[model samples]
Target: MDNQFPIPGPSVPGEAAPLPTPEEATPPPPSYQAPVSVKPPVVKPSPIKIILPLLAGILVVGLLVYGITKFIGSRLPSESVTTGQTITLTYYGLWEPSSVMKPVIDEFETQNPGIKISYQLQSPQDYQDRIKTALEGQNSPDVIRLHSTWLPLFAKNLFPAPANSVSATEVSTNFYPIVSKMLISGTQVYGVPITMDGLALFMNNSMFQQKSLLPPKTWEDVLSAAKTLKEVDPLTGKLTRAGIALGNTGNVDHWPDIVSLMLLQAGVKLTDIKGAEASATLSYYTDFVTKHRVWDDTLPPSTVAFANEKVAMIIAPLWRAPEIKSINPSLSWQTVAVPQLPDSDIVNWTSFWFEAVGKNSKHPQEAWKFVSFLASAKAQQILFDAATSDREFPQPPANKAVASLAQNNPVVSPFVTSFETAHTFYTASNTRDAKTALNSRLIKYLEDAVNAVSQNQDVVKALVTLNNGFAQVLSQYGLVAAPAAATTP
Candidate 1:
């Protein structure tokens, strides 16, 4: 229904209508122009839309973890092996620090999964005393670092490696000739060495130069040089500046070792205390103090006197160089192989240490395995090279092949030469049984003889006493049979 008034009004008054139209037009301006509805096209959601971000993030993180793990695997070769429960062994060491052992122990653990070595560093001074205590108890370490001189005393407490682990033939073939002499007794291989060491002559180069003397190569040369170099207090009749640190127990360090050198050089078999050669050797060692008066009890320990420039020379080991520097940094010294007997076959004493398994070890098999690794050429070489800092020389290489590697080193040259012809006489006991206990009372007996002679006691009487005491100790220990030596001197 439309209103009719609009058509009449449109013709009648343009002016009036215009006025009305203004309002009317404005009023009906957009007459039935109803808003047209426009709708946008619909978008369908993706299948994982809700979880896509979270899922993608997780996938990226997982890939990152996999990549990192693979990268780590590539870096550690030792971790390649699948492992079971770890076996931890305690190792006691007197000479080497934990820092030095760390590298090899870590590498070994890497190579053999589930094996851990707990190295306990010890002071060399208290090492024997402590180990002796540990051995008597149930809580002792699985492996121990034992000195060669201590072997005779501690051998009964150590576990002998089964022949298959370190056989006699292998010992003879792999190690220096001396190793078999000091360590292998009967069919048992008591220990394996990382490196070997022996007594060497530590000479004061300046003193030798001042006196215009050469390094002694024989007993007679040493005696002549000692006489020339010694300075005596005219009033006290005592040595003010000793020529050599020898001939006595109280004044000389390693007196037993010195006595051993004398006995071996003179061809006095330690097993034969009653022999004429034994008596002669005892007299000779004492004569330096009793007759020559080159060294006396008034001075400090041989090494101390040597360090203080109160003495001209000392017979010590490869380890003595650093000790000298530590005591007196300005001291100038040099080493030569220990002086041999005049015009006799060359011989030297091996005062070394080796790694061994404890007889009471809870993990004998695993402990032996670690010992085997220590004896390996690669390990020995690493040990030798690592030990070079501030030492007289790198630890003397024990492996026959390894020894050849360091043979040309000036400091090691003499030691290597000594290793070629070194001889050790462990007082052979009378025991025939393999596991019988044999004590090392020879060093004690030798010291007593040397001490007696230094006091101007009868050399013949001293020898007799030493022989009787040695026999009684041998009888007490039941060491009647000779130890099986793979190779002989």
Candidate 2:
């Protein structure tokens, strides 16, 4: 999914307690002393002699206890406070099953010896709300799995990777440039991504071969191919086969990503997305239905349509490939980098989950240690290996070193290679943030804008509304859009 960084709110100081009055501070002095009434009473039998011996005995016992306690404490392991007792870190995670994560957790525990990972797989349904609740509650998990777009919601409640564990330089240097943009704020790194994913064009290889066509590389190429591949019933003027999946969010997965990509490719600043640049981009996206008529609302959802061979091409993240394969085991398909604007630098979009430590965690140090390990090259490779064993295709590793080794793999190469040019915004879908979530709320505005354009309405007003929605939602999370850099693909 999509994600961003955050600015923590200023802390409010507690009111100091008022000082006590003299009467309350001073207690009656020595009530045990005998009353020195006007007449002096006979002294008790050698009271001083009896008290001195008792005091001597008490002091001897106290010294003995102190020495014994010191001896025991000194003999114990130095890490006993944090490790000897064995801290069990509760990790709330999603997507990865126990089998896939057990190996990675086990490896971390073995190395640390003092930390135990209590990994719990979470359902994606209402995960943003659930996680937010957990993070704010008294018993939050030590580590949590969050979409990159969720940083704005959870940043204040999260513990940035401590210097002793993962550093800002390490994050920027090792992972995709987008990771730094999403997870880093100044000197603090908020989260560590285990995998990298983004939109890619999944095309039916057989369909292309039959038409003697190749995968499109630019907007012009995409249009031409869509025209040739699309099949329309001449008499009825109905679509029999869709050239590609686009135009409407109703049947399109990742429509938010597709729209954001078009905007970025056109150099429309997402923070202030309005004006001609945005209007033209939105029109072009909706035109796949309104003007070109290659795709329409009548078709099945993109993934389902592609699986059933009703569409020649669809844009989706690598994770969806497995679902498509399950739908049609015999279908011949290939993935390519998302099409870019002609004569412009390649700008790709990415949305993936990362591991973050809760600020309220009792063991923040140990929690970050485990998260840092998860982000390491060795752990990423292990995770990739385990995931491949448990499933057919896993999202490419976020670590560049690990991703580089997988560059030769056909299904993974297109996405892995696109990281250098990858960027992401909050308009990512399927993150399951909450009804009131930042991404979900922002997506609603975007959907409205797309629907307006597809229906041939005044898109400028829609764009204006969408831009305001972006600002409002981002401001709620204390975030202002940091525009992605213009880069050559």
Candidate 3:
């Protein structure tokens, strides 16, 4: 669907909000980090080693005793907690201040004084390794902050949001559809998101007025607009001015996600490793560079190009909006729900974070209680208000009621309206060797295919290689691996 919201002059014209810095939101999660290179990024491994068997046995015994103590402690009432009865629960969070979370955490603690919560913050890169190691050793935090796309890696160590705390029916009824889809498996609901965010097109208003062009509504319109807005050298046939940032890895922001948008919109079954639809989608996405010449290797990083007015359009989640504004607040731009595949059902890509309870927690029930409260409408509004104070725009609320009230917000309305149709995918962990990382090979190679196709490599062959690499990863994890095929469906 074409975003119905008209492009307003300037939403927040003055100083931009800096709640989520670019360093925080680049690739995948609403806090996505752009894969900055053709080579799939590998984060520095954590120094913690698996405990030795002798020590591990002792640790396990100690943890058992502690669990029993905490269980007994939890039996105490909130108003009746004494020194020995307080059930302290550890929590891990990313990208927000303690102050932001403190307000809600305070309320949760106040209502349940016996279950006191202790919070810790970690950088994303460090947190990924730290939490994984902690969970492996049974020292996992009581509650975890999970990305919608990252739960696949952490699922084994996490407890499903228990029915007694938050039922699957309540979850399905309260949050956007994607929330349940991403977090639920079989009959279990895994995590709950405090906010929801999906990719949207960020267009340069000055460029639009100068050329008298409306924002691109479909892929065809995008290509045509790319050609018209772009400037090229007559003799060298090299681009001097790029139209839209697409098809390349180093320059284009969130190219992996952009490819996901194309693949899903084209009805490619992403789980089918060797499907023909996957290859065709790759070719179509790369064609923006190879065929259209709208974007070239010479362009700067996408968000920068768009901010400097060197490009006309870029696709990113609402989180990226603050980044562009931080770079150049004076540059004019407005967001619209990402353009859809022409003549197809409306679809958009969403990537955001969620909170879940850890399986190993001594106080699993208490952890679930806090998680359920975090997803409630009352808590979500408090969350939105807190984030907005630090950011130019708040993350769209995941609560249907909360989102409905925000439907009038130009930036959020389109997203909230489209939440029912939004989709998400798993993000492969960047750690070199986790036995169960789906994104490690598939998503990274998907990025590699984009880089390859943009350089005029054969799209089929590239996809075939991507399929082969992806198959190896899937098979390693005991999943069924199929050979690549020539047909799209």
Least well predicted 10-residue stretch by lDDT in candidate 3? 13-22
lDDT of 3 at 372: 88
Q: Write the per-residue lDDT of candidate 3 for residues 1-489, one digit (tens) a residue.
A: 221111112221111011111121112457767668787789786545634666788999999999998998799787666456778989888777787788888888888878888888877665566777886666778888877655546777777766688887888999877777767665577778888777788888888788999988877788778778898889998787788898767778777667766676766645543455566666666677777778977888888888888888888767677778888989888887787765457777777788887777778888999998898899888877777777766678888888865676676666677678877655322223233355555667777877786677787788777767766655444343444555887
| Residue-wise C-alpha lDDT for candidate 1, range 223-297, written one tens digit per residue | 788889998779987678898887777878776666766666665556555455566666677777777778888
Worst 10 residues of 1 by lDDT: 13-22
Output the lDDT of residue 310, model 1.
Answer: 90
Candidate 3: C-alpha lDDT:
0.71
lDDT of each: 0.70, 0.82, 0.71
Collision count for each candidate, in order: 9, 5, 9
Query: What are the runs in model 2 whose C-alpha is more than 4 Å off?
Result: 1-83, 481-489
lDDT of 2 by residue, 203-254 (tens): 9999999999989987777877888899999999999999989888899889
Badly placed stretches (over 4 Å) of model 3 are 1-84, 233-238, 273-276, 427-436, 478-489
Top candidate (TM-score): 2
True-structure lDDT of candidate 1: 0.70
Model 1: residue 25 alpha-carbon error in angstroms: 99
